[model samples]
Each structure stands twice: as structure tokens, then as C-alpha cells.
Target: MSENMEKTIGEVGRVDWSHFSLADFLELRWRLLHDWQAVLPGGEYFGQARIGDVCYDIQIEWLADDELAVTMSPFFPHDGDSAEPPYDELVSGMPYDTQHGASLISSRRSFLELTYESFIDLAEHSILETVARFPHLQSAASKQTGFWDRHDAILCKIREQDDEDR
Candidate 1:
């Protein structure tokens, strides 16, 4: 996580969500997604994260003008092993079989609709909550094989380059 994000997490309640613009919210979203991708493997994006026994699938869609919908669903790992489905498959809702008779069952109550500003608030709160509840997500992710680290690292480097260019 970046220093700014850490600071934001520390002072979550004090931040004014209403003052954030769409671009600011998107930057925060990018950082949050990057951290999630770092911890979860097998997706082109940060769509899933596993904490202990339950895996969470995150989906976000732009609704209108500054409004966005975020859905987070927790499911037992597919076949009791994998925590993620492919990005394309997830977007398309493609069917695939799992092993050991396990299945994916999503609850309908895990949806939230908010403006981009409120979404940013949720993002900050979630970052703190994830760290508090699942401290090992990042450490465990370090031990797993995934492309997120490399991908995020490249993004970081590019951002650094852009900063230098400016």
C-alpha cells in the first residue's frame, strides 16, 4: 500500500467524501484494485480476494453521473481450492465445473449503491476493515503464485515515471 492510502485508512472517518471528484475517486479505486490484485491471483483485474475460508468477489459498475454500484459476494472456494474465476468468465457469467462437488452460491444481499464519493468512503473503510480482519491476506498472497505483483509493480513504475515527467 502507498503511504497516502495508509494515512487515509488511519483517518478514514475524518475524510470528506463529498469533496472528492470522479478522478480522485478513480485514483483511489485504482490503488484499491491494485492492492486487491496483489493479494488475489488468476484474474486480469482485482476481482477476488480470499480471507481464510471465504473468498470475496468484488464487482463495480458505473451507474450514471457520479453514481456507482459495488457488489461484494462471499463464497466458499470453488471445489474447495480456487478462489477466483477468470476475468472474462466472470464478466460473461460463463459456466464452469468445479471439483469435489463444491459450488458457487452468491447471496443477494451483498450489493451497495453509492455515488463516486461515497464509494471512495467505502473503499477507505474497506481497506481498514480488510487489514483488521485479515492481516494475513497480504502475507499469504506473497507466498502464492500470481501476476498481480508484477503488474502492480509495473504500474507503480509507470506512475513514478509520469510523476518525473511532470
Candidate 2:
């Protein structure tokens, strides 16, 4: 895990997006998705986790050359259908419930843009914030506990490496 953490941090640190090209952003996105999968077991780009009986799908989208979005919403398990719920429905009122056995009781989405010297700065801050808020989520009976724990541990290791470098 530490080796993967080092590799992820190294890749993030090596990103030179001063030019802010689309290709650069794509590469960063790929690396981030890869790192998330590698560090968080069973975690995928658009994976699902459960809390009690409800299940939520995690979605990642490249909104623009400089922005990325991560969303979590209630979703029915694979039932031979590949259609996603309407965007409006997902982002609507809280605890959005659907007849498809999925309910967005506590869904959330975050958008991050490249507005710093290194994209890692934003990514690191986001991870830290997520980590700090994990306890609250868990207390609220969120099923994303495992994913958040792994994600936080990896980021902490990366931050430690950064500190050692200084």
C-alpha cells in the first residue's frame, strides 16, 4: 500500500500543468482514477457501496479541461439495464428516492478545478477534507466507510512523504 501511495504521490507531484492542456488533464484524471482503484480495494471509477439496505453508485466525470466531478447517488444494482438515472433526478432534493430500489438519502458530489501550481494540491486538500469528514459520514450510517478509510490512509502516507521531502 505504501509503495502504491508513493507511486501515486510521485505521479501527482510530477504533473506540470502550467500549460493546462486537455491532454495533460486527461493524463492526470487517468492517474487519479488508477490511484483510487489501487489504493481503495473494490473501488472503481463508478463503483457502488452500501449502507444498510440502500446502495449508492459513485461516478466520476471530466466536466472540462480544468475540472473534474465526483458524485455519489442511490442506484439499483445491475438488473440487466444499463441506463443511468436522470441528472436532474440525481441532483434534485435530498434523499431522492426512486422506484428502482435505490434512494439518494445522502448523496454528494464535489467538483475540483486545476487552479494551483500542481493538481496534487487540490487533490490532497480534497482527500484531507474527505478524511476529516469520514467520522461524521460513518456516524450517519454511510456505507462508504471502507473506501474512505483506504483513501484517507493512502493520502496520509503521501502527505507524510511530502513532509519528508521538505
Candidate 3:
């Protein structure tokens, strides 16, 4: 019934798998590490969406035996400097413009009982919303759709590796 749910159904042929489902859960975990190419890299995953001078830092918090929470923060570079924010500054939950020296806009959304496919769709939808407001993000928007697409490697890795310890 939610917007995310609508986006996830059969999008790229993936069902909105539950986090509580063991079989689907492990597959989701491995698929994340494989698609993002961050295999077995601790608990949290960090990624970014760059739209010209602004970069949206995306962090996925993997909760044990449960759901995943994704947080995104937008950061602006000063005078063409493209450096990422200090590690501590990531996920500040504040969107700021370094050139202006002040936080400007903020937006947040929450989805209860999150699903792997819904998260993907929600993330893409969030990014697309941001892109609509920020003209600079339009150019990079084309490259971001791939992130939501179904990845065959998810099943492949689950088949090849043992997740008993995980």
C-alpha cells in the first residue's frame, strides 16, 4: 500500500523479500556485499551519490536478525574541492553547503518493516526526488538506476559461499 511497496513489486523481477525470512535474508546480505563489492566488510555499509558539487553519503545499518536502516546525508564541497567528509561527519542527518557555511535543507522518511527490494526502490526514489530539486544531480541520475536493478550475483554468491558463520 505504501509508495515503496508499489515500486518494489516485480521491478526488475524481484519480490520484496522480508528481513525475517532466513533464506531470503542471507541471500540479501550476500547480494549487498557482492553488488556493492564490499564482501564481509563489517556491519555497516557506506556509499555515496555524487551530483556535481554535492554528494549524498549513503549508509546502510545492518541490524542483527532483523531490518536494515538506510540514512543519507548531502554534503557540498568548497571551491570545487571534491573531498569526502571526515569519517565522523558522515550521516550527520543534515544537508549542508560548505560554500555557504550553513545547513540549508533537510528531508527524512521512514519505512517500517523494511524489505530488500523496497529499500532499493525507496533509495532510488529518494535520490530521484533530490535530483529533481538539485539541477546538478540530473547528470548523474542516469548512472544511479543500475543500483536498484536485480543482480544475478546474489544467488551465485549464496550458492558458492557458506553463510553458516554469518
Candidate 4:
């Protein structure tokens, strides 16, 4: 049933989107925002890859307790998310608008707890949902050995670029 699934399942497996909830979406979104500011400059782990006549933007973040969020955004010159503060503000201990840093930590959810297996399941399930929604990603990546290779290469390039900048 799934030719576009990441794994070789002999057309046996399919995407499971039965467990979707707006609550989970909002919670994970906040987690991602917090991770963006806490771990990455400019609130994103950004990368670019050319995929079959189109270049796509890739974003992946590892949240607290091994939660993972991977997003694939196709780039159009006019479209951008300006919600995040500039690279300096996100990395620095400076707040973009607020007087204190406490307001910046809106993504905290101390009461929510999930098992290790649940965390892994959420990540894998999210990825499958994305691929099912955008079959182009699977089609473009079908020939690649690993879906993460492009992301890793872009990270290497970022390191080189950082070195050069310094």
C-alpha cells in the first residue's frame, strides 16, 4: 500500500494518520520553537537541497528528551517566516521585544511526560505523515541511500561556511 514509505515494506505498510490532534501539534510546535532558540542560531537548523528540478528547504530539530521534528519546506523567494528573532538575538541572551528573558521561554511544558518509545514513535510517525502529505519528497529521495544524507552534507557545508566566516 505504500511505495513512498521510507522503509522497504514490499507495499505492505501505509501511513497512519489516525492519531492527529491539534493539541499535540501545538505542543510539539512550541517545543520546536524553544529548541530553535535554545540550540540553534536564528531559531532553525536550516539546510537546502536540490531535489529533482526543485530546491527544497529542510529543517530538523531535536527537542528535549529525544523528540525530533523534521520539516521540509519548498522555497519560494517571497515566502519566509519572520517570527523568529534575528540570528544574534536568538543566540545571544537578548530578548527581541520583551524586557526580560522569562517571556521568551513560552515553550515550556514541565507537566507533559512521554515514554522513550512514545517519543521515538512520535518522531517516526511525524516523518511518515510528512512524506505521505508530500509525495514529492519520497519521489525525490528514492534514489538516495539515506534521507538524512542531504541534511548531513548541508551541516558540513555550514561548518565550512562558519570557519570561512571567522
Per-residue lDDT of candidate 3, residues 1-166 (tens digit): 4454344322222222221244443454454545534433343424444434345555544433344444455544222244644333222232234322211222212433455456555654555455445433333332333322222234335445656545
Runs in model 1 lying further than 4 Å from the true structure? 1-69, 72-113, 138-149, 152-166
Q: Which of candidates 3 and 4 is the stronger one according to lDDT?
A: 3
lDDT of 4 by residue, 1-166 (tens): 2445445222213322233344544455555556434544323433333323223343454445444444434321111244644322222232222112111011223213543346435544544444345444344333333323444466568778899999
Alpha-carbon error at 139 in model 3, in Å? 4.7
Task: For candidate 1, report its TM-score.
Answer: 0.28
Kindly list the per-residue Cα lDDT of model 1 for residues 1-166, writing each as its tens digit: 6565565344322322332356644643664445433422322223444333333445544334433334444333123244755222221222222222221221212222345656555654563454344323323322323333344356568778889999
Count of steric clashes across candidates, in order: 0, 0, 0, 1
- Model 1: lDDT equals 0.39
Better of 2 and 4 by TM-score: 4
Instruction: Tell me how candidate 3 scores on lDDT.
Output: 0.39
Better of 2 and 4 by lDDT: 4
lDDT of each: 0.39, 0.37, 0.39, 0.38
Instruction: Give the winner by TM-score.
Output: 4
The model with the greater lDDT, 1 or 4, is 1
Candidate 3 Cα deviation (angstroms), residue 163: 26
What lDDT tens digits, residue by residue, belong to model 2 across residues 1-166? 2454444334322222233344544653555545533323322343444442223444454444434455444332222232543333222122222233222221112223343234334544333233223332222232322433344356568778889999
Order candidates by lDDT, high to low. 3, 1, 4, 2
Candidate 2 lowest-lDDT run of ten: 101-110
Instruction: Count clashing residue pairs in model 3.
Output: 0
